[model samples]
Target: MKSKERAIVSLLCATTICVSWRGFRSCSPPQDQRPCACERCLSKDDPCFMKRFNKSVEPFLSANYNLSEDDFNWWKRLQHEKGNFRTFRATVARLFLVIPLSPDVLEPSPDRCRTCAVVGNSVNLRRSHYGPLIDFHDIIIRMNAGVIKGFEADVGTRTTHRVMYPESSVDLDNTTHLVLAPFKILDLEWLTKALTTGFKGRSYAPVMVLNPAFIRYVHHTWLENKGTYPSTGFLALILALHMCDEVSVFGYGADSDGNWSHYWEKIRNKKFKTGGHPGNTEYKLIQELDQQQKLKFYTGF
Candidate 1:
């Protein structure tokens, strides 16, 4: 064979070895053998895994910090609401005085895989018997009037985090964390007044307000700005994805009878539909995530 031809063949072999070595290094597992739900798709080059997950978005608001004009304006437009910026700043200042300014953010760890169960208020949870399964998770996140007294067999009794807004707020114990999803500035004022003076009842739970920027991220990136805004349950599910290494969703879609009422409430409206939110699109996205094995989704019977 000619010397030039030999040189070209050697170069091709060297290039193949280099590419193979790089792929091996990238796919190598960590030293810790413990299983992680995110490791599979993340390491296997799943196209949709990291497409919508924005790590730079902060999940909670802190004290002594001011939101940018763009963030404030975008957040206030959720409900077509209006409020004075000065008043909103003052309310946050007062709120920080009473409770903690900055709560500890949950970061992903190599040694431990944090599991979270995001429980919704869908009517499908009526007889699921998922109470034990839900309680087994490291973090049990319940949202929006998730009652546990009578339906403890289905919805579970333990709650590590409770997501709520001013209108859908419920009394919480000291152990559970109150995650407030404020859409308008008045919601912030309501949280301050509720904690300082008391709203419907007293609550000693630690408070964490969802960041407006994070909400915008979910709407534009995840939902592609499909609806007016994402619902509270959807927001809580996304928040769990950020906070936990593994996530299991429960009681999300409609029941077998196609009713859209809450688990605790009777079927008053058969044709009840979500207001201003793209409920169907969000559910389809969730189904896709489940299909891709990104998160475990439980469609309760």
Candidate 2:
């Protein structure tokens, strides 16, 4: 009788366990097993990023407008802490892909019919007369007021973005995206000032591409000795890699001839022969990157 009672209890426990498991499945099904929502179905069919991107760039599409509350809050937060924008990690505190970066807005969408040209501040491109070809591209990113008439032939008249420093002499406009290469406390001060009315004009909210992210990426690939600043041209190329599907590089240091002096400086009565920029090691590095077809360099450099 004792054995029989023990068997009965075991049978009852097994049956209860089976029922509880089925009930649990009914309550919390696996992702595949669960009934899908319409939103989930649509999400699987479409990229969530596209909708988010459309919402982000709506102002740019409409007109030169004020920053949104969400944009402001997002920028304000990243303005202090910080990724593609990350290519290294040195400290344990460092994280990658933390935030999508500069709000992940499509600069120019498919329907927008925009081609992009990233002009570097290399002295090698002085008086090259490549501006027309460059302007034909669609959106031109020029640094330090590198402009010429009839030059918008290839790239376009739209100086869509200007990568600048407080010390830079570049003239900015609505489309300008001030890229701060912050290294210290004072750097933050200057960036904040630009974002505000400190520049003696209607304040523009800059894209705030954290150089620290690229700084890390440089080290990730280059290791401890990532080479100084790795050339703004290199940074520009990396930017293209992340944000653009197709990108063209202009006024870069393809000058193995070591000739320095950009076309802009020549207009301002500066020496065209001045070798502007850091060590040649970075130049060689950029050349290698270009050779790898990471970016298309102007044939004439």
Candidate 3:
């Protein structure tokens, strides 16, 4: 071969070896020997937050309320930790059955754009006339004790999902999903009991519990554990990001007069602001997210 041709061929061979070596490293398996092709699948410049998030919280998804020593130890650790959780271990253990793990209820689909509306109970919703608009979404998620009965004109009556703990448990219709945000083992127990046998002389329709990992994600990563944990509405918005292609948040924060009251309730004083929750911080965060075009944040009408 001519010297020039030999040089060109040698350069091409070296280039191929370098490319192949990098590809192999990028496709290396993770700790579980499962393919960890994230580096190859996602561009480094592209912000793949969701992909990173799912990987980070995989363990929390596997947690179950089984009545075993390990399960009891897990609950014990959570109880000792500084957070908002009501202890109902004794009551829950009395049920004498390993609570089966709930399936992932909010999996994403590839073909459709899942629109979601996270409706908070703030009084700002009153006279917003967003009822019809709110109802248009594929999913309408309401927070704890968020009523739509009388004020259906302001807040839509079409509720696809309701998020609550044991204290805020409400009677859900057959169609609406009951997504439980368990703060403690008792909350999980209450959810199981509510769906199965009656708990505290009351039973609810079948319910789904949020993956503990997702909840932990919202608390540690999103809220930075700002105030014990993120509020129900805040957590709901985070959950929406995972399940929906587009997310619209409504009825969050205080109203015009700076009073934090429910749309259905009459505001007596400004003292009704969100207690134990960093409302202002959360509002600012929501606004920042809006500025980034991650989601639409409607402060009011």
Candidate 4:
């Protein structure tokens, strides 16, 4: 780990400080005696619940946004040394000028339950037939290139948000939100260029960039500083916890045969791993969340 990262981990370990959840004003009210949708509002019986949701971190970047020096340095060190703060700021400025930016905040409601389904690209979804169940949610969030063309019965056709990087991006209709999980400065540059040049013909769709501070928050708090950074799928899962009253996870982890592959594609590499992300740790966290009834988890066969 880098010196800065080590310091961050040490600080978290030393203080055990939990940041407040910032964007949402209210959390969902419980039905009967059930737990609320927002984990922060859960009963204090589980001490660790307090540390899970950090409201201080903004989820999406808006127009005329500026990152503090500390956040800038921490974000730049996430993947590669793409450029300096000046270059990053300039790129963001130019990008915001061309593409329309929106504050995509989903506030909790007392009368309504905003359910969300976070669908990953795991091959386990192949024959799950979770389409109707997934589409039943108020919001459906898909990640990367987890295609839904012919696999609609298994992956669902409705997608409120699609979380992706430049490489894993797919063309979408205007109804879906293109949530970019930027790993490096180059990914931001790519988004700017892609939107400006009409890359993948996605100029009409709504766009939102994930806040780097939120990324850091997830790294330090949610994953406990595990792996290099949290995977895009895991980030989307956390985002769902903040945006919806009820959350359901689908298409994550290896299949019944312990094979890792995309649902739309055949398994070419039997020895596939989650690359730089801590796959096991993340899956374990997901299971724990399920156990706590924070979110409903479906493990497809």
- Highest lDDT among the candidates is held by which one? 1
By the TM-score metric, which is better: model 1 or model 3?
Answer: 1
Task: Evaluate model 2: give its TM-score.
Answer: 0.54
For all predicted structures, in order, the TM-scores are 0.86, 0.54, 0.69, 0.83
Query: Which ten contiguous residues of candidate 1 have the minimum total lDDT?
Result: 34-43
Write model 4 residue lDDT over 1-301, tens digit each, in one string.
6999999998886665333232122232345443443443334455676678865567887776777778889988877666888888887888788667666656664445678999999988888999999999988999888889999999888998999998888888888888999878889888888877887665546688998988888888999898999999999999888777788999999776666679888788888888889888889999999998878999898
Q: Count the backbone clashes (under 3 Å) in each candidate.
A: 0, 21, 0, 3
Question: Where does model 3 exceed 4 Å of error?
Answer: 1-100, 104-106, 199-206
Predicted structure with the largest TM-score when compared to the true one: 1
Model 1 alpha-carbon drift over 4 Å, by segment: 1-25, 32-45, 199-201
Q: Comparing candidate 1 with candidate 2, which one achieves the higher TM-score?
A: 1
Arrange candidates by lDDT, descending: 1, 4, 3, 2
Over the stretch 122-154, how does candidate 1's per-residue lDDT look in tens digits?
988889999999999999999988899999999
Shift of residue 71 alpha carbon in model 1, Å: 1.5
Sorted on TM-score, best first, the list reads 1, 4, 3, 2
CA deviation > 4 Å runs, candidate 4 = 1-46
